[model samples]
Target: MGDGATTTEAGPESAGVGAGLTRAHWWILLAAALGWMFDAMDQRLFILARSPAIRDLAAGADPSALPALAGWATALFIAGWATGGLVFGLIGDRYGRVRTMALTILMYSVFTGLSGLARSWPEFAAYRFLCGMGIGGEYAAGVALVAEAMPARFRPIALGMVQAASSIGAMLGSALSLLVGPQSRVGGWEGWRILFFFGVIPSVLLVLLRFRVPEPDRWLRARDEARRDPKPGRELGDVRAIFADPVLRRRSLIGMTLGMVGQIGLWSIGLYTPELVRDVVFREHRRELAVEADSLDDLARAWATETGGDADSKLSEWKAEADRHVGRGTLLQDVGSLLGAPFCTWIAIRFGRRKAFATAYAMSMASVWLVFGGMSRGVDALWMLPLLGFCTCGIFGVIVVYLPELYPTRLRTTGMGFCYNMARYLTAAAPVLLGRLAAGAGGYSRAAIIMSFIYVLGLAVVPFAHETRGEPLPD
Candidate 1:
């Protein structure tokens, strides 16, 4: 512990009042939740829109090269995420968390909308990368702010709620795709473009946040103490402070390792739900078409001749069905995520921190395997997608609740940001690996199953994580 080493143990007086969160706590939680929610929406929007954007941009290029281009674009976004997280994390420590958070929200919101104006693949990628940087910075600042501000007893719920709200943001993206996507064409703009434009909505929240939300008292106190110190490296929010001592360094590494497991499992495997849905639905459409065409050849020929149309009408119908299938799958996944986020809080509170993580890891592995391995039909996917979403994304709840508790106010954001974002360097390559593995005989399922093993690594590391339940935020 550094400057603010308040004992985590509950005193008799404090223990008696296990009532409810205060107004300030609710406000902090709401602000953090809204920011994180929009961040998630933008991320899912990019994932859903990437293919269409790439296809249009690569219009004259070889079709086979489009997948490679998508991979590169995804990698670029991850690069931006990693870079922004590291850089803004330091800024958060040096500056006030609320100020840094507002700036990050503005940064991501503007760039995300600008991504809509991209004319070519490179331009689109450039804008997305910039947007990713903004997205990356928001989490550290928001989580750190909420962790330090909320009442210690309510901290877990507040943090978990913030992470849970992201599922709604993701759902908003999916809903937009269904409503304004290329198929629907709201306002005559492409669905992807319209979705990107919606990114501007979050900037509105930024105004309210900056005007109303207060900086954590802990951060203010730490800054004041650092200002009074005359020694070298007495500066507030020093990123290096996390590694200056053995205990801090060990905690930092453990947090980072845990984050790495979640990132690889998520970015590589879970995020690919759209692609898998598309493939399964399209393949099913083709098979059904073949069977129908074979069974009703004479009747279909007569009907076609009478209607003055060819077999293309059936193809159009199949396309529509495939789209519907994918839309439904996405909706279910979001629903699962909604439920899972809250469930994480319950589990962590009922059990301890380590056990909660262990259970989540186990569930993640099992759900992912079942979704990708045994399922084939769109209907089957509709049921399985939510379970996958629940397990994969729900675990992030632990991050906001656990990481900040491990460090003191001085190094809190720095250590938390470092741990959360450092894994991006390795996980950035996940999309490329997924493409390669999908190209194999086993396809996306095999690749996803292989990737799910990343969760097992998380389970292995759970024992080493320091238990933080009922503990106060380290000064």
Candidate 2:
């Protein structure tokens, strides 16, 4: 690869001395981190809510058919992600990062809230696709802003931290799932709907971003320079520019492939933890549910005749038990993710970007195999969930740190967004493909095991990766 096409190796101290990271830099990181955090939370909320929403929508349909419908919904969401990433990435480069960030946040938040109003599966899927577009745009904008703003020494660490913040969003989503549970009713409405209604929380960040954050100096300078001496295929935010040259095209292909590997693993495998929890761990609660059902029937007469206190108490008790037994598996996985995300930063700092990515990919493959192949008990999942999260989710830290390094400032957002979000097109098929595999193979676990080989492609890409550790962003 041409040197300018990718990050060149730099010594630890080569980040070199300048004015150092400023107050503006810190503010930018915070803004980017918050945007990414809320974006991730929105995604996690969908993951937790998808099955329940579909189950409710298809109440009268065959139970076995729910997975297929859910898969279709996921595909639609992924398609939206791909579309938003491509379109907004160009906008980010040509317009500005902060403005695009605000627009995307609004788009996603409004759509997510609207998803709660979806009375049918098709309606829900449409809302989710729109939400996915907003979610998809935020990543490239936030990461590009932070990458360009921070000092070189702090760039990787800041990018990792920004990526790490996404785990907090996922954790919050898990907490929301736990708080509401699928069966809980509020104002006679299902908890899943309420959870989506709350998806508007991220929209609140728009004020902070618009009022507090400023566009990066690098982007401003590059924008001015591009206008002054524009060249063919070198226009700001032009998607065609990314593929106009051999070096950029090669880097773009590798970067997108790397992103696809992680996206496939996450959307296809990691997001299914809730399903496993429901099917495997929650199965043990069947007897408890049966007992509660019998008790509820007896209490119904008492509720009609008496003051109804006893029936209310019994219902509350059952709801608590059900909430405790359900979603625990997915929540535990979130805790694991919290730990894993930061670990990626430490790994990238200690080793290099390539090593960190390779390690994460290898561990993800193995951990996934162990989780799907042998995990039959809830207790086993407690320990294994963290390992699975650490590997699968940690690799993203490397991606945010590494991808922008592959492009110059004028094309940074466009290239990074295309590489990351365009992969969604391939990954968008993950749910459908896995659904078929699960049905044909007779189980989710078996299909997951077969899917685990996708990580090997990540490992193959490692040798060709452009090492960005301690290096400045390409100028």
Residue lDDT tens for model 1, 253-280: 8889888888888888888887677667
Compose the digit string of candidate 2's lDDT tens values, residues 1-475: 1111112224463345233666667778888898888888888888888887998887887666777788889999999998889889999999999899999999999999999889998889999999988988888888888878776666777887888888888888878877887667778998889888888988888888877788887788788888899988768998888888788999999999999999999988888776665554433433433333222335434443554466656555644554554456566777777777678767877788789889889889988998888766555666776678877888887787789889998999899888988899999998898877866785678888888899999999989977766666787
Task: Tell me, by lDDT, which candidate is best.
Answer: 2
**Cα-based lDDT for every prediction:** 0.77, 0.79
Model 1 spans with C-alpha error above 4 angstroms: 1-21, 182-188, 290-317
Give candidate 2's TM-score.
0.89
Task: Mark the regions of model 2 whose C-alpha exceeds 4 Å error after superposition.
Answer: 1-19, 282-326
Which prediction has the highest TM-score against the true structure? 1
Model 1 — which ten-residue stretch has the worst lDDT?
4-13
For residue 268, give model 2's deviation from the true position in Å: 0.4
